[model samples]
Target: MDRHKVYISSTYRDLADYRARVINFFLSGKMPDSFSLISMEGYVADDIQPSDKCVEDVAKCDIYILIVAKRYGFIPPDTTKNPGRFSITEMEYETAVSHNKIILTFLADEKQVFEEDSDPDAALLAEKKQKLLAFKEKVRLAKLTHPDGFTDAYHLCFQVQQAIFNKFFTEIYASREENLDKIYFCDRRSQNYTFQKGRQINKAIQFFLINSHEKDMAHFFVKRIGLECIESDIRTLDLFIYPTILDNSDFDDLEFSMRCAIKEEWNRNAELKKFKLKDPLDVSVEKVLSVMDELNYDCLIISWEIKSFYWKNDKLNENISAFYEKYDQVNATLKTSKKIFFIGTVSYSECADMTFAQFEDKIKSIRYGATPIKLTRINRNEIKDWMTDFEIEDNPNVQEKLLHDLLPGPDPDFYLSDLELPLRNILMKL
Candidate 1:
């Protein structure tokens, strides 16, 4: 196994003990593979870490581990076009990002971080807090890491280890390019409409009446279906996401608009890097049919965040009507792929709040007189079933815990808004 060098970036004084524990964790050889650690603590310096030297070390590492606490750390002189300069810790993070290092970030909860200066000048302290907040925002925006929160060194270490193994080893071993014909999946998991989430995404290709998190669930099913496609050699799975539209003016033709929008998320999504994607230039009935020709693709997921187009200027509304009218036929015409879909999203109040009869009318209006599909909502039983299904390589008993702790009361329906935050919290546990 190649020895992956990991760089640790954080403020020094308050985190000194935590940093030591992490260094010891690496030194103890508990990791599945070989790893080398690089930290300022090791470089014979207490607080005199030069920004240039720190970022230089960051560029040399294979992985970057960032810890954010209360302090913003020492700021160095302006460099590399960064306005108002930045802390040495943040500079290291920026360097790691620029060099494309795999980053895992863990944040300390407010209770876990005690301000060393209990009473400082209000103005100076406020300035520091603002800068720290801005830096935390940067970390969250980067999306290079999930930014799991931790309360203590042990919790941080455990989660960091879990994140590392899940991202690298577990993924490497769990996902093999399998020949699905040889290995069979349960009928429930097969390439059919049995999986509720999978079916919802496939049938309702565009427009999720979900109040919150339009594509989060969509992405989940897409990945799950992608796994199914990999298992069976029926047909290669391909995903084409017609990126999120910003404003009408931002729309640069149909094809390039999607491509440009996709670039913003392209680096953050590893699964997307594996997709055999295509850019559709034409929306006409015949050209779309030609484009949908299944040369090698079998299972395909097309998620176009067409929400902007639905509410943009009158011209766009007309264009969208014509566009959906043409592609609606392609949805009916495409026979080669096992699954092909488009999914848009909106506020729950805006879409699914009405009665089913009213919803059907709304759907008919949006879909131009075609048959409508029922919006998927989660129930208590499904949440229980999902918790029961949660299994992790690092912790096999995690499912039991999740079932006991996360399983909600027996509600008949849990809207998308209801479960999104809890779902995120559950992932943090992993």
Candidate 2:
């Protein structure tokens, strides 16, 4: 008989360090000797591509561990190259979903959730952005009914092992009576119930000013599941993060688009002080630097086109040195890793060679330590491509029906015939 194999998947930013620690805890442990597990870190010696190995591992393994964190995984870092591929974390989830593999997920932060009615930032990222929120809803529902969601970190390892143990001992080897005792999992507890939101919620929610009322929702979920029955119910859990930026300003379309597409967290400031300026260049750079100082973020995602103008300003050529000086000052003060990812070309028509060339020159001038950096230029071409993919995956029929049914009249009309030519045509025909 073959042993069941398990594979673990995670995003490296924000939660990778913690995930590695958890994996190590399980890897360097006293196991039942019969059980087996494999991970991405294990395949480094084989020279196998991480994504390929992950696909293979998920295919072979009976179970997969998805470390759901706030950050989306990286794209190839060069959107000018291949943009059709999946992020590392997304590839893992997608593979598991397609293969129908039993995925055992651990939600890193459960308290944070998408507020359905919030004003959307950047109309461009709305589609991908909405998908992320919907995914969270599904995971939240799954956690409410899965065994893995209820178990503590200590017992989580034991319970997963015990599931394997039951299959071998009871299924493979015939036993007279079922292990009924194992089914009724209960620990010594004098108190009826105690609830506390995880630490990730506290740290993350602070930046967004998410009120206590929002934070307290996690406890409500725990209560609904019931302490004793929580284990028996939940089978597969999902991790989700409600993302926000500093200054309480909504995450911009560019930031939202990049973050959601890649499934990585944007390095955001906790808060920023106001510095009014007449020049757009001065205002932008000054605001950026102020936020960077407040947040202590090592990485900065500069708007490629805007930053280039500042670099090329004739009057501020000497003064622009001050901008570079401030950048250096921040670099010197950095205590942790400072990696940057640049976003470019939200519209494909804007993809002039000069725009990219200008961006490249500006990027080269910004000095930092030997930090890993990636520049993603998302012109109209990429947006159309992304839009096409989203259209395919997102069941447009359901939405269409919903719109038709929910609207006031038989015909869903929003705009006049002449003004809304394209949209009116599509809506009317559909």
Relative to the unseen true structure, what is the C-alpha lDDT of residue 6 in candidate 2, on a scale of 0 to 100?
70
Quote the positional error of residue 96 for candidate 1 in Å. Answer: 6.3
**Which ranges of candidate 2 are over 4 A from the true structure?**
17-30, 42-50, 77-85, 112-131, 138-430
What is the C-alpha lDDT profile of model 2 across 130-161, one tens digit per residue? 54455556656655223333112322333343
Each model's lDDT? 0.52, 0.36
TM-score of each: 0.43, 0.32
Model 2 — TM-score against the truth?
0.32
| Candidate 1 global TM-score | 0.43
Deviation of model 2 at 36, angstroms:
2.3
lDDT of 1 by residue, 243-347 (tens): 434335332454366554444343345544443334433323233333435344444444443332134344443444554565555555444334544443331
Q: Considering every candidate listed, which one attains the maximal TM-score?
A: 1
